[model samples]
Target: MTLNIVFMGTPDFAVPSLAELLSNGFNVVRVYTQPPRKSGRGQKLAKSPVHQFAELMGVPVETPESFRKPSVIDDLEALNVDVACVVAYGQILPQRALDAPKEGCLNLHGSLLPRWRGAAPIQRAIMSGDEKTGVQIIQMAKGLDTGDILLSETVPIQPTDTAGTLSERMSRTGAGLWPRALAALSRGGLTPTPQEGEPTYAHKIDKAEARLNWTRPAKTLDCHIRGLAPFPGAWCEMDGERLKIHLAEPSQGDGKPGEVLNDALLIACGDGALRLKTVQPAGKPKMSAEDFLRGTPVGKGTILT
Candidate 1:
C-alpha cells in the first residue's frame, strides 16, 4: 500500500528527495517549504527550489514562518499525513507538527548525526578535515538533530573535494537511500538507534570567517579554502584586492607568515607554505596560479596583507 507522506524541504539540496518520493509513487499529500524571500543582485522575491518544484508538480505547498501556531497545526492535521519527510527544510518542526504525522517525521540530514548536527554540516565536515561524512536518515525529535538514526550511508571526503562538490554527491546519496529507509519503516524493520556521546554544532558560515589567516598551518588553510569554495570563498588580501582562494595545496617553505616565498604564489603560513592553485581576484573570473602570476607579479619577501 502506498503511504501518505508530507514533504517538508526548502533549498536545491532538498529538491531531489521530493522528486524521489514523487517518482516512487508515494502519496505526497502536501509540501511545506519556507516562504519566498528577496534575494540576488536584483533583490527580487524568489521562491525556493522545493517551492518551485512543488508548484510544477501540482502539489499544494505551505510556507508557514513557524509551525507553532495552533492554526498551522490544524492545517497539518487536516492533511492527515501518515509520515513527514524533511530534508534541508530551514524551519524547525515543533512538537505538534512532529506528532501530526501518524508514523513520525524523518529528517534527511547531510551529515553523520552527533557529529555535524546543525546548519552548515557539509561545509563544516570539509573545513574540519574529516575523512568521511554522509547522509543520515533520522527519526525526528524536539532536540536539535538529536534524533535516533534510521539509516546511514558513508561518503568519502577527498582532499580535492569542495563543499559544493560534496553537497551534490550527498544530495544524490540521500535520494537513493530514502526509499529503502521508508520501506524499512513500512515493514517495521527500521530500528532507531540512539546517538552516542556529545554532539558538535556546525554554526552557519559567516563572511568574516572567509578571510584567510596566514598565521594558520598550511593544512588548516587548505581545508579552509576547500570548505568554503564556490561560495563566500576563503580569501586573502593581495595587491590591495581581496583574492579568493579557490584551490590550494600544502607545501614546505621558509618565511614569515603571509610572506610570498616564491614566484609561484607560495605564501608562507605558520608551519609551512600554501601553494595556491586557483584564485579569483575581486571583479575577476577564477584563474590558475600561473595565469594570475603572469598578470600580477610578486617575488620572495613580498608581504601579503
Candidate 2:
C-alpha cells in the first residue's frame, strides 16, 4: 500500500527505527529533528544522529523549534502523511500536529506502559532497580505518554545492565515491533489497549542526583551507579576530588557507611558493601579500580565521603 510516513525523532535511540522503516520500504516523505545545538569543549554546533542519518539517506529534513505556530501546523497538514512515527522528538506535540496524520501519530516509548511514562524512562527503570522493563508503541494523544498501546515487548533487567546497555536493547526491540505494528494497522487488525496499572512518572535525570550517598544500601547504590553510568556518572568525593563510579557490584561486607574495607576498593554501605570495578577520576579517562589504585592508592580504612 506504500504507506506515507512522516518521521519525527532525535538522538541515537531514534536512529534504528528510522533506518528500519526506510529499509522496509515505507515511504518516508519528510523527517523532523531537533535543531543543532552548541556542544563539547569548543561549543561547536552538533547535529543529532537522526539528522545526520536522514541527510545521508537523501530525505528532506525540518527543524522547527516548535509546532505551536499556525503556519507550522498548516505546513504539516500540507504533507498529508498517512502516519507520523515519533521517537524521543524532545517536544510536546500539540493536538493539531497529532491530528494531522490520517492514521494518527505513533510514539516509540522506552518503557512498559503505565510505568516510567515520561522522560528518562530507561534511566529511571535502572535507578529504581526494576526486575524488568520494555518498549511500547502507543497511539499519540495530547497528554504525556497517556495513549493507547498499539504494541509492546518486555525485556529483563540484568544486575549488570546499565541505562546505556538497556537502551540499546530496547531500541532494537522497538525497531522489530514497528513493521508488525504497521502491517496490523494497515489491515485494521490492531487493537488499541488502554494502559493499565498505576502510572509512574520518570522525571528527567538531573546531574545533581548522580552524587553517591554512601548511607544508602549497597543494592540501591549499585542501581543508582549503573543507571547513570556513561553520562553524568554516579560520583563521590575522594580526597576532595570527584571520582565517578562507572561499574560496581554489591557484595557481602559490613562497616561504617562510606568506609573502605580493603585495598580492593570494596566500600561499606548502610547494608553490605560494593566492590568497585571501574572508575574515572576528575579530568581522567575511565580505568579499572585496580589500575586506579596502583597510581593513586586509597588505603584500607580510608573513608570516602
**Best of the candidates, lDDT:** 2
- Residue pairs with clashing backbones, model 1: none
Please provide, for model 1 over 42-73, each residue's C-alpha lDDT reduced to its tens digit, 9 standing for 90 to 100: 99999999999999999999999888789999
TM-score of each: 0.95, 0.98
Q: State the weakest 10-residue window (summed lDDT) of model 1.
A: 296-305
Residue 178 in candidate 2 has what lDDT? 88
Error of 1 at 1 (Å): 2.1
The Cα error of candidate 1 at residue 80, in Å, is 0.2
What is the model-wide C-alpha lDDT for candidate 2? 0.93
Q: Each prediction's Cα RMSD?
A: 1.5, 0.8
Best by TM-score: 2
* Residue range 260-298, candidate 2, lDDT tens digits: 999999999999999999999999999999899999988
For model 2 the local lDDT of residue 218 reads 99
Task: Candidate 2: list runs displaced more than 4 Å.
Answer: none
